[model samples]
Target: MGQGLSCAASQDHRFFSAVHFGDLETVNAMLERDPSLLYQTTYDRQYPLHIAAANGQIEILSMLLERSVDPDMVNRQKQTPLMLAAMHGKISCVKKLVEAGANMLKFDSLNGRTCLHFAAYYGHSDCLQAILSAVQSSPVAVSWGYSRFVNIRDGRGATPLHLAARQRRPECVHILLDNGALVCSSTGGYGSPGTTPLHLAARGGSLDCIRELLAWGADRMQRDASGRIPYVVALKYRNGTCAALLNPSSAEPLVWPSPLKFISELNQEAKALLECALMEANREREKNILKGTGYSLPSPSHSDDGTDDNISEASDTELCCICFEQVCTIEVEDCGHQMCAHCTLALCCHNKPNPTTACLTPPVCPFCRSTIARLVVAKMKDCNDADQDIGDGGSPKLRKSRRSLNFSEGSSSFKGLSATFGKMGGRGSGRIAAENEWVDKP
Candidate 1:
């Protein structure tokens, strides 16, 4: 027994050293001498496969897999070799492990996070795409459905989307969204309940991430457990640009001439004419308003005796002017008038018209007859709310403000918006034009 124990220990030291340094020849020779050395665990319970994958030794990893080593063997943290490879951004190693039948859906017992989650958290876009492709092509994924693994949530109830957004991985965010990852999925773990990917993006101050999420139909009006929407979170973190983009007032209102006519069906010439007309009309209206000669449009009325009724309504200490239920926690921009974030977002940003209109109406301040420039999240004093604690120890924490908005150096361009008629022949326009043909037919 003593002799066997000594031999195993000696073999483990040499095997671990060889795998750690990626000495392919030494690893193969040792494995040939002691076939069982491939399965031997180090002091940390990490196998030769885990070491090779972690260190990005693709050649050694390939050799181990070809020798029929267990691909799914996990370490003390319950992290498999595939997870290690993904977390370290070893794309080639990850692909090899996946092709060799590594368990892609296996989650770490500690956090219940899958390999995709690790790849996303580490900002490995290529690694993430490879894992996604492997899953889609796998027979098990085909039988069980790819979404089952793609949307797998961690113990904290956070999906891979949440991690990508939180880590400010714009490429990973786009890849995940393109693959049908849920945008509005909320988390109930790690002191964050009902926190969506938009909230995470806002907190991280990732403008590209925010844009991607919004383009993918993320609900900005969705609130966290603290009753704060992504816009409010952006303001709280001083991400002014993100907040402005999310503000409904910043979007130009599209006025359709006819309810039956679809914007997509309009030909290039017709669309140009309509745009010119709208521009002329806006210029004339602005000039008239500036000259005080324009006809008065219907607006909210003020109170008699020189007291603003709107201000009074907003200043109601007992009730919120927007929701009329919850207490006020958010304040409108440029006007100190208060309202709940939930109500502010719903009243200003989420008020969608019928399908015929297909336009977004800008939100105005209820207390003041001015257009809402932006919304600011007021800092609460002595608040012990669980949602207020947004730290996860090792992950990126929300900052009061960032020096710059340029998070990702990659291209910021994304396709999903309604294509303009002028750019019909451009790249990505073919699909949009094809889809709109049915609208113009008959």
Candidate 2:
């Protein structure tokens, strides 16, 4: 019998490739020659059922199961056909396996996760629904009320709910909750972040899943070992909806920590912006003063030279800054310093006063860090590589030439500087302009 099975196994290999290639009739012919061939295993210990499930071959799976093939048999990794079916979202195959009494509760020997874990992680809603249906119909009183699914850790100590939450599958989260999955279950699995399912959901900013977990009595009060609560995580992420679910009793509507910080940073930015506006007004005033005084404004060439000097000085003193983008508005500081407004805003304001927007700024620039500023500009420049440093205090002749060029309003040239130069292949002008347009566009 063993020898016959071994010979059949070799034939099964040929048939397995045929099956993978969709040669159904050929597979049928091989199996017909040896009825017991339906139960054969391949080099990977994968039976026809495993291949069928993994490949979404419903007909082939049905035929194999009808031959009494073991649907729950595990490979070397202890992953059963049911697990593969659930993972791959083969709904029909999963249903067939469940109907054939494939063990949904069988955990992978390596990961200690049941077939349901795979279904939940992959967001296979149909497969999950079918598995839950089978479990509900089984004689074992399915524990639908205990958050058992939530708390039951896998080899990694992650509950089914954790996988769902981490993958941002709201529907999967709902299914797990309905099946008595716990929201607070943390994995004892090595290197596990020791976070509850709620923590995972909140971190991913899935408000719906977070709400579902909270609705099912997921303990909002429980803090992960990080001393971070799910609500705090939501607030930290600027997810107002999730934060609202966590704290409902505040007299003053609790703002997300990130948004609050954003506002405070915005205030500082507003002041900085106001200062910049004033300085710009002064520069404009100076320009007017020169014009009205009949100082015989230098010839366009001479004026351009002075302008180049100004730009050079500006480039050196003013930091390019971004407010929300790489460069949305050129932030002219009180002292006339400029940078990308968005980058500066991010560096200076995004994280201040709010956990959500924290640490977006680097402490120093890779090149020069006098506290980098984000800049937004009116136009972009298409200068060649040699021209990149033209306005940054280069040769006196280059500076004079830079001053003569007046920026054309609404020109494509005015639309391109990003706060970070690397984005433009180490040039910085184009990004600022691009960010300005992005912010101005509705």
Q: Which candidate number maximizes lDDT?
A: 1
Clash number for each model: 0, 62
Off by over 4 Å in 1: 1-11, 188-193, 252-442
lDDT of 1 by residue, 93-186 (tens): 9999988989887889888999999999999999999999888879858776887777889988889999999999989998897677887889
1-442 per-residue lDDT for model 2 (tens digits): 9999787657767888876666778878887887766666777777777888899888888877787777777887899999999999989888888788887667787778888789889999888878777776674336442334334568767777888888889888877765556455666445444688878787787755654565444666667777787778887887655565455231111111122223234444354543333222222222332443334322231122332223443233122332211222443322233444334332332133324854343223222233434332323333444256454657544453443232223223222322322221101321112212111000
Worst 10 residues of 1 by lDDT: 400-409
TM-score of 1: 0.57
Model 2 residue 387 lDDT score: 51
Global lDDT scores for all candidate models: 0.64, 0.56
